[model samples]
Target: MKKLYFLIFTFSFLGYITEAQQLLRGPYQQKKTPNSMNIRWRTADSLDAKVYYGTDLNNLNLTATVSTLENDHDVELKNLSPYTKYFYKIESGGNVLSGPDTAHWFRTAPVAGTVQPIRVWATGDFGKGNDGQRLTRDAYLNYSKDKETDVWIWLGDNAYQDGADSDYQAKVFEQYYAYGDIFKFMHFYPSPGNHDYNSVCGIPCQQDPRQHKGPYYSIITAPQQGEAGGEPSTLENYYSFDYGNAHFISLNSELGSPTAAYDWIGAYTNGASTSPMIQWLKDDLSKNTQPWVIAYWHQPPYTKGSHDSDLFYEIYMKAIREKITPILEQYGVDLVVNGHSHAFERSYLLKGLTGTAATFNAQTNVVNGTSGKESLGEAYIKYTDGTKPNEGTVYVVCGNSGSDVAANKALFYNGSPHPAMFYWDGGTGVCGSFIIDIDGNKLTGRYLTSNNVVKDEFTIKKQSVTGIKNINSITSSISDAKVFPNPFAKNATLSFTLSKPMALNIELFSTDGKMSRVLSNSSFNEGEHSIEINSDALHLSKGEYIVKINEGKSASFERLFKVD
Candidate 1:
C-alpha cells in the first residue's frame, strides 16, 4: 500500500512540471529610467509572470512578479541603481524561461544632464523580415561587438504590410532575420511610421490619434510622465528622453486630427499651433538644458529619394518643412533624422530655408557649405555662446535600413541632387543605417551600410564663444599672422603684426584640444613680430596643433602642422 502511494504521488509531480508555460515573445526591455526598467514578454499559457534580477548575476536576490495570469507579461524592476548593469531572467509559474546569462543584462541611463559617452543605433523601415534586415542587423552587431548600444531607436515603419500582431511577431519578435538577436539586450524607443499606424486604423490607415489604439501601441511602452526627462507628453505617440548631455525628442508625424481634411497636416498646421504634439515640442525644447539636441520622426522634411520633397502632393514632407521646421530651428535643434524615403540622404549645415528645393539660397540657407567631414578638416562647429544660436541643423534621411531602394527610385531633385543635400546614396542601391556617438561636446554620425562599409560620415563639435568682441578687437590689432614652413621638421616661424602695443602670450594646443606648449609670454611693442615654434624645444609630436595668441581678454587661433 505504501509503494503504490509513493508511485502515484511521483507521477502527479511529474505531470505538474510538464505543464510549465512556454515563452512566446520577448524577454525584452522597454522604457528604462535611472531607478526602474520595464521588462516585457509573452508566453504560451496564462500563468503568473515573475522576474528575478539583481546587480550580481550569480545571486539574483531581487524579484518583481505579477500574479495576474495572462499570455502577455510586463514586469517592472524598480529601485535599481542609476547607470548600473543588472542581470535578469523571466519565469512563468516558477518555470525558468529565458536567462541570467551574459546577454540578459541592461544598464540604466546615466544621471540626467550628465556628460557621458553615449552610443545610439537607429533603424528605419527595417521590419521586413528578410535578409536585408538581417544583414543590416548583423553589420551593426559585427561593428559594435562588445561595445553595447546605449539606445536603440526605431525610425518607424517597424513592420511591413498590415503591421498586425501576427506581423510584429513574425517580422520583429520571432524571425532571426529581423532583430531577433537584438531583443535579449538593447532597449528600444520607437516612433510610429505610416505603416505602423496601419495596425491602428485599417487598410488605408487614416488614424485619429486621439483614439489611437492598436497592436503597435500595445507592443511598445512610451514614457508618458517625464520618466526619462522633459515634460510629460501624456501620450504614447510622442515623448522625449535625456541620455548623457544630449536631449532626444521622438515626435509622431503620423498623428493627425480626426477633424482635419488631410491626415498628415494635423501634426503641422498652416497658422495656429493647434497640434498638441507641436505644443509639447515647443514646451519641451524651451526647458532643455543639454548642450546637444537631436529630434527624430517618420516622414522627412527634405528628401529626393523614393519620394520627392518638391512635389505639392507630398503634403507630409511639405508640412514638416514649412510649418514645424521653424520651431525646431527656433530652439536650436542640432540634428533631425527621419525614415520614409528608402534611400540615404544627408544635408549640409542648414537653417531658415523652409521652402521648396528651388528656394534654397546658399547665402541665406546654408550655414556651412563644407562637407563637415572630420578627416577633411571641415567638421562643423557650434558655439556655446548666444551669438551662433539657431544657426545650423544637419538633417539625415536614414530610411533604407531594410527596404532597398529600387532602380526606378529617383535620388535627385530637378535632375540633380537637392540643393540641401551634401551627401546621398546617389542611387547606389545600398541598404544602410545611422550610428551616432556623442561624447561631451563632439557628436559623430556615420552612414554604415549592410556590408559594413562607412558610406558617409560627419562630425560636429561644440565650443564656447567667449570674449568674441575682445577677440575681434585683438584680431584687428594683429593684422597679419602666418606660420612659415608649417610642415617644419625642426622649427617654424609664427609671424604676426601688432597695430598697438600690448601684453601678448603665444601658446600651442594639440589638435585634440589640449595645450601642448607656451612659446612666449611678454609685452610686445606695436609692429611685426615673429616667434620660433621650436619642435625640439617643446618636444612636440608630429601632428597638427593650434597656435593661440592671448592679448588680455582676447584670443585668436591659427592652425600649424608638424611633420618628420
Candidate 2:
C-alpha cells in the first residue's frame, strides 16, 4: 500500500508540471541589429533556452552560442552579415524536451553610406485587428518584395488596447509575420505612442514589466560611422542615429512631461544641427545628397482623426516649433513623417511658425504687385514681425494604416491653405502608404493605396544659388524685359534690368534646347522695368527652363522655374 501511494503521488506531480508548461507558451519579443538579433520569450518554470539558425528554413544548424540566464529568458544571435538573410527558431527543455520547431527568417542592412537607394517602410497607428491593417501589411509586403527595403519604421501605436506583449503578438507580430521573410531581414525602428502607455480609461499606469522599458531607443551600423550609427540612450526609451545622408531622431511621446528625455532631445537637436552631425550631413549631401531630410515619431504635430486638431498637445508642439523645427530648417530638412491620426494628408513646402518668421525676416525683397503674386494666402503664412509675407511649414497627417474605429472627415478638409495635396476618409480607399524617391537633383513623392494605385504625386526641385552680378559690367545693351514676381511660379512677372536702355528680345526655351515662346522686342529704359510672361503659353514642363533676356549685341541670364 505504501508503494501504491508513492506511485500515485509521482503521477500527480507530473500532471502539475505539464500544466505549468502550457501556461508559458507565448509572450515573445524580438529586436534586430545589423550584426545580430535578440529574442526573449517566457516560460512558467526555469529551463534551458536554445536557438537554431541557418541559411535554410528546413534545416537549421544548432548554435553553440547558447546562453543561459536565471529567470532571464532572452537570447542573442550575433555575427550576422550585412544585407544577408538567415532563418532561426527557439526551443526550451522540459520533461521530454519538446519542440516549438517553428522557423523564422530576417535580413541585415547593407553597409552604411553605400551608394544604393535605401528604401524604408513607414506607418503608424496600425494595430487594429481588421482589414485596414491587413491591407496595409500586404501592400508593404508587395513593395518590400519589389524594393527589398533596408528598414521598417513604426511611427508608434504599434499595438492598440495598451502596448501589452499579448496585444503586440496578436495585432503586430502575427500581422507582420505574414511577411516574415521580409521582416526577418529588415530592422524595425519604433517609437512610443499614447496608447502604448496603457493610458486607457483615463487611468495612469506604470510601465509593463513584460516588455522592454519605455520603447525609445537608437541603433547604429556599418557604412555609417562612430556616434551617428548606434543607439546611445536607454534601449527601452529615447535614441538617435544616422543612416546614409540623413540623421534620424526618434522620441518617446508618452514619457513624463518635461522629463530627462526632453533635456536629451534639446541637447541632441542642438548638437546635431551644429557640430559633427551637421558636418557629416553636409558632406553626405555634397556627394550623394538626398534632397529630403526625414524624421519620425509616434504622435503628430497636426492631426484631425480621432484626436481633434485643437486637442493637439500644446507643450509638445511648442517644443517642436521652437527647438526642433529651427534646427531642421537650418539644416534644410524637407520632410517630416508622422503617424497617429489614421488618414493621409500632405502640406505644401512649409516652414514651421518659427522658421517662417526667420525666412521672411531674412528676405530683403518682396513682390506684391499682383493679387496672385501676394503671399500664399493668410493661412500659409504667419507674420510674426507683421511686415513680411507668410511662409509656413507643411504638416502631413498619414495615420490610416489600419481599421478605423470611427471616421473623422473634417480632418481631411483643414490644411495650411497652399493647396490640399491629398486627403482621404479612412473608410474609402485601401489604407495609405507613401514612397519618396530622391534621385540626383529632383525629389518625387508618391502616395500609393493598398491595391497599389498611385493616388497622388508631387515633386520639388533643387534651388540654385546664383552670384550677384553688377549692372554696369555688361556690354549687352539692356532692353525691354520683364520677369514678374522676380522669383516666379507657373509664370513670372518679367521686367528688364538693362545696362543701357535698348530694344530687347525675350524668349523662353525648354531645357531640351527648344524655344517655346517669344515675349517682346519692344524698346525700354536702363532702369528696372516690368512685363508679364504667361508660363502656360510656353507649354513648358515642370523643370529648369531657360528664360533668355537678350538685348542688341550684348548678354543675358537664364532664369529657371516650375510650370505647374
Candidate 3:
C-alpha cells in the first residue's frame, strides 16, 4: 500500500513537472453523432496520433491509437453508446499530453428523435485576436459556470490578418487556448466569413484562384456526407448537423451559390432556386424530422449597423434576404443568426414580405405585434402537432465579437433604426454573445453582454392542441392606450379609458419577469385615467420595460420606452 501511494504521487508530480511537449492547436472535436465522433489536434513535430478513453475517469483503459507519423492528429472514436459520457486523454509519443483532468470528457449526442436539454454557444466574427474576444469568452464562461456546451459554432472570420497558418496560431490557437477544454469536450463547428476568405477580397492577406481556395478552405473539416446527420451536401463550404431533436445548417453567404452577389436590383436574388447550396437546403429541410431548425452564416440578411442590409451595394445581405429567406419560410425555419455587423440586433417574429428594408411593412410582415417577450405574455407559437407550422422565424445579428479597434467601433454604430429590426444596440464598447438552450418543447435564447447583463431574452415553445389558449376569451376595457411623450426621461404617463367602472391593478415589471413596483391597486370609475410611472422608482437601465395593466382577470401589456 505504501509503494502504491508513492508511485501514484510520483507520477502526478512528474505530470506537473517536465511536461514540455507543446500542442500546436486543438484536441478540437468534430463530426459528432450518437455513436461516433472525431478528435483532432496539431503538434510542432511529426508524431503518431492516439486517444485513451473510457467510461471511468481514473481508468482510460480503452485505446484508439494510430501509428502513422504526422503533425496533424486525427482519431475517430466509434461504436459508442447513445447519450453516454466518455472520459479521454490525448497522447503522442507514448506520453499523456492533454486531459485526464476534470474538464476532459464529452457526452455523446442523444439518438435522433430523442428529446434532451442541449446548450449551444454561438459567436460571430470572433477571431479578431484581441482582449475584447477574450472578455467575450470569459463573460460567457462566467455565465455558464461549469456547464459544458454540447454544440459550439463560430460565425466565421476565425483568424485575423489573412487566414494563414501563423495567423491562426497567434490569433486563434494561442489567445483561445484557455478555452481548449471546450474544443476537447464539445463539437466545434464554424462557417467562413468574408475575412476568412480575405485573400479573395480586396485587402488580400493571401489568395488562390486555382480552386477558390483560402486558409478557411484549407483548415476546416465540415460534414459533406451526412455523417453528423443531415442531407449530404457533397461540398465542404456548406453543411448541416443534428443534435437531439434539432437540426442546424451552416452556409457560406460570402461566396454562396452564384459566387458573388452583385449590386443590381435582382442579381443573385432570383438564382437561389438554381444554386447548389439552396437546392441542398430545400432537400434538407423537406426531409427533416426534427422539431427545431436553425441556420447561421457570416453575413446577416437584415441589419443597419456596420453593414446595411437595405443598401443596394451590399448585395450579399440583400440577395440572401430576398432569395434564401423565402425558402426557409416555406419550410418553417425557427431562427436565422449571423455575424458581419458589429453589434447585437434581434428582430421581431416576421413572416413573408422580403422585398427590401423599406418594403418591410410592419403591419403585414411583423407577426404577434407585441414585443415577443413571454414574461409580458407575448411570444411566437410553433405547434409540433405534425399538421400546423404557423410560427414566424426570428433573425439575430451577433456581430459584436470582432476586434475592438477604433475603426471597428466606428464600424459598429454606422447606422440605426432599421425598419425590420425591433431591437439593436451599438456603442464604443457595447459587446456581447448569445446563448441558446433547448429543453424538450421549450427553446429559449438570451443575449449575454460584456457587462454580464442579459439585455434580451425570448422563448419559442411548442404546444399541443389542448395547450393552446384562445386570445379572444380575455376581456379588458383599456382603449386608446398610449405611452407618452413617446420616450419619457423620468416620469412616463400611461393613459387609457374604460367604458364601465372596473377594478384596476397597474404594475411595472422588468422584461425578465421581475415585478418592480405597483403603480395602482384600487377600483376606478369609468372615463379616462392617467398614471405616472417614475423611472427612478422602477430602477431600470436605459432601454425598454414592460408596463402591465390588470383589469379584473383580463390583462393588457405595453412596452415602455425609457431614455437617458
Candidate 4:
C-alpha cells in the first residue's frame, strides 16, 4: 500500500514542480471575502514569496509581494473585485515555484449576502494520512469534473491520533497538496475534534484560548471580526462566516464534551443566559439577515455511528440537542452538521426532540410535508415568514470523508443505521463527504461517495419575504405569512406575499386576543416579504400576544406566546 501510494504521489506531483526548491505544503486559501483573499504556501527553505496574479492568465499584471524570508508564506491580496476569477503563480526568491496553469487560480468570494451559486466541499474525520484520505479526495475531484469550489469545511479530527503538527503535516497539509492545487485556491473553515485536543505540551501558541491545550489552536486561522460574515468572534476556536447568501458557522463542540473533560474551552448550558459561546450563537443568529444558515462542529447531536448517541457521547451531544438545538431552531437555522462518529449519517428533517433514537417520533416531530427531495417532487421548505417557521433541521454526520468504521465493525449500535437517518451506507463502508450548493433560495446537499456517486441528494427551498419571486408561487405579487417561535421570548419575523402592490396594516392583540397596538401601517411591493416585532419594547410580560396582518379588508391572524 505504501509503495503504491508513493508511486501515485511521485507521478502526480513530480511534474508540477520544475525548480530546485522543495514545495512542502499549501498554496491553500483562507479567510476569503469579496474584496480580499488570504493565500498561503510553504517552501523547503526560508525564501521571500511573491504572488503574481491577474484576471487574465496571459497578462499577469498585478503583483503582491512579501519580502521577508519565510517558509510558511501568507500573502493577503486586498481591494480585489468580487465574484471574479483570477489566475496566479507563486514565486520564491526570484524563481517561479508553480505556474500560470489554468488550475492555478482563485475566484473572489461572491459579495457578502449576495445571492449567487456556491459549491462547498465538506469533510470530517478525514485526515488519516492514508490511502482512504487520498481516495476520498480523488472521488470529490472526479465528481467535481473541474467545477470551482468556493469554500471547504473540515469537521475536526482533521488529523489522526493526536492533532500534532506532524500529524497535520502528513494528513491535512501534505495530503491535500498532493491531491491537487485546489487547496491553494478555496477557503477552508475548520473546528477541533477529540483527537485534536491532545496536549501540545511545550507549544505555547497552540494552547487552547480557554486554558485547554491542543495543537489545533496553532494550525488554523479563522476570521476574527466578522471579516467573512456572521458575528465577530475574536476567538479562532469558533466563528461564523458568510459566502454568497449562506451564513456558515463553525462551533467548538469539543467544549461541550463530557467524555473529553480535559478539552474544555468553556461550558454552555440552557440555564445560563450568558455563556460565552451560547450568547455569541444567539447574537450571531439574531443579527444575521441571511436567508440560509448552516452550522457545523465536531460532535453530532444525534447519531448511531461509531459512537452511540443513546448510550454514550451524550455529554456534548445532549447539551447540543437540548440546550443548543432550541436556540438554532428558534432562529430557523436550516442545517446542523457535524462529524464525530466515523460514518455517513444523514437525518430526516427533525424538530423539538432530544434523547435517544427511540425519542425520534417522526409522527409529531418530523414535518411530513416540510421536507422531501426536490427530485422526488416536494423539497424541504423553510418558511421565513415567521408563521409556522419550519422547525425541522436536517442533521448530517459527515465524519466519513477519509476514515471509516472504528474498532469492531459489525458490533456497534446493533450494526445498523439509525431509523431517523436517511442515507447511511454510501460506499464499501460508508466513506464519503457532502457538497453544499446554494443558488438563490434553493440549497441542496449531495453526499458524494468515494466511487464518485451521489448516494443521497436533498434540496431545501427557503421562501423568504426578501426573495418572494425566487420561489415557486402562483403570483408575481403578495403572499401572507406569520412570524415564528410563536411563543415568543424576544422578537419575531414574519413572511408575507404581495401581488402587484398594496398597503399593509399589522396589529398586535393582548392576551385576551383583543386589538391592542398597531405595529405597522405601510405599503409593500409585490412578492414575499417579512417583518420584525420587538416584544421587549412593547413591554409585554409573560403571556400570549395576537398578531393580525390586514391587507385592506383581507386579514390573517396568528398567536404568539412570550416567556422570560
lDDT of each: 0.81, 0.50, 0.73, 0.73
Which stretch of 10 consecutive residues in model 1 shows the poorest summed lDDT?
Answer: 465-474
Q: Candidate order by TM-score, highest to lowest?
A: 1, 3, 4, 2
Q: C-alpha displacement of 13 in model 4, angstroms?
A: 18
Clashes of 3: 0
Off-target runs (Cα >4 Å) in candidate 1 are 1-21, 202-208, 261-272, 413-415, 426-429, 466-564
**What TM-score would candidate 3 get against the native?**
0.75
Question: For residues 1-564, could you state the per-residue lDDT of candidate 2 as single tens digits?
Answer: 999999999998887677555434332324444566565445566766776777677777646334454343566677877656766666666332222233255565445444455565677777766677777777766755656555566777777777666666567646343222233344566766767656321122232212334322111121223233543443345445544544455555443232232232222224223333333334433343333456667655544554443332444443444555555555555566677666676655554344222233211222111112112221111212111112233455567777352442444444431122233445454476666654434445556667766565555444331221322223445544434443455666765566656787766665445455776778877677766666567665554444566564544554444523
* Clash counts for the predictions, in order: 0, 34, 0, 20
Question: Using lDDT as the measure, which candidate wins?
Answer: 1
| Per-residue lDDT of candidate 1, residues 326-408 (tens digit) | 99998889999999988889998889988898898875677666677878766776655432444689999998888876655
Error of 3 at 101 (Å): 1.4
Error of 3 at 230 (Å): 1.2
- Which residue pairs collide in model 3, if any? none
How many clashing residue pairs are found in candidate 1?
Answer: 0
Candidate 2 achieves a global lDDT of 0.50
TM-score against native, each model: 0.80, 0.64, 0.75, 0.74
Best prediction by TM-score: 1
Error of model 4, residue 287, in angstroms? 0.8
